[model samples]
Target: MALASPTVAQAQSGTAAQCQTSGANSVPELHKEWILVGWDKPVAGQSWDFREKLGKYYDWEANDVVLYDDMSPDFQIARSPEEYRALWESSFQALRRAHHLVLNGPEVIAGDKLSTSTLEFAARLEPPESQPIISVRARSTLVWRCTSDGWRIVREHNSTRRITPEESRQLFGF
Candidate 1:
């Protein structure tokens, strides 16, 4: 579906919608929209086209609480792109039978660098528990940044849960 056309002022003016620094990084708001766009299509260039969305957020050193917290040597460093994609595919395949999706972006911590917005998502399953099939809706958040390349994802989080359309209506008002 086409996304709503909320003005930049409308986005930044809201509590959950603001991700940019008026003076420092104009990337937060950009990131928020990029995340929405990421859902609609591929982001940035095709450098990571081989990648699927599952573990793609690992491209950056951010986590969605399912993985490491801040300050893991693992988080401080990442595998080669090839290795990262392998892990992403593995995770995606593992999740093939589940439903719903959620991903949260990173909250800015310190430094002139911002941590991008959180990508929160959720989904449901067919069997409703273990050994279930993934046949439900999913949603996620993506963090965006203005890069030497262009606006791109920096961090994201993922999950799964079942939600009713009424709940979705309350969540995104879409």
Candidate 2:
């Protein structure tokens, strides 16, 4: 498929009518769903397409993300939508380069979206036949800018920390 260009979502409406008034103010479940769609697994060269998919769920224009308060240093405090796409591509490439052995999903986490669901899932990496798949959640405390197409992840304090089986037991009580 083609990559997501600056104009791909030009024809789509940036704001949904009803969504403009109510949904405009806060994050919605649809936003989460859109993320799931784009993030189920790392897409090779299809990053822009995924971003377009996410745009469908929002009534805002996705520009770039910027950060205010950050507790992580591995990522930048701000990012453009295009920048976010590039970051994803970088990590996905890393996984491939490492020949990582990954597991499939439900990819369940221990919490809900209520601030409790603070896990940022990216892509997991593991040794073949390992006891458990390492979980990597990509997260950013940056801001999302609304673009003509939809909500774009602009800023990021992205992190991909590995979770060991022992840690998983501690976090999930499994």
Candidate 3:
């Protein structure tokens, strides 16, 4: 007999309905949904596609979204939808040029009107000619709010896990 695949395994064991079904009243499921649609899908997009998907999950009307990253000292603040569009547009371009992102641990908590997710992930930057791929791990906490449409992110704070210079050199190979 053939072994059941992971997708089939979850479905057959009733865990899929418990954690994959929308409207199933499961926190894990909602968390799973948010993470996939919010981060995973956007990172997988190319060129214009990433921007399109970024707008979907972000709350444009709030007009107070703040994105934090390790590369900058100040927050990447977007006070308006136009600015929001610009930030993500530039972000997608950088992602397209510099690195490939992958999502890892997503610990989520669903609340009455707001939810939070702590995501641990890494980006593998394309290296020079024949150098080994360089990877950097970071963690982000995302704040989500329920809207008439659905859940949307209102704030995001991302920080790189502290690494020594030697550790960075080893991993990134300078």
TM-score of each: 0.34, 0.42, 0.56
lDDT of 2 by residue, 53-142 (tens): 433432233343343223223554434444444445444333321112222221222211111112243444332343345554345332
Name the top TM-score candidate. Answer: 3
Model 1, which residues run further than 4 Å from truth? 1-77, 94-115, 125-130, 133-145, 154-174
Q: Tell me model 1's lDDT, rounded to 2 decimals.
A: 0.38
Q: 78-121, model 1: which lDDT tens digit per residue?
A: 33434444444433343323222334543433222234454444
The segments of candidate 2 whose C-alpha lies over 4 angstroms from its true place after superposition are 1-26, 42-64, 67-74, 93-123, 126-133, 136-161, 167-174
Model 3 clash pairs are none
Candidate with the greatest lDDT versus the true structure: 3
- The better-scoring model by TM-score among 2 and 3 is 3
- Cα deviation of 82 in candidate 1 (Å)? 3.6
In order of TM-score, best first, we have 3, 2, 1
Q: List, in order, the clash count of every candidate structure.
A: 28, 17, 0
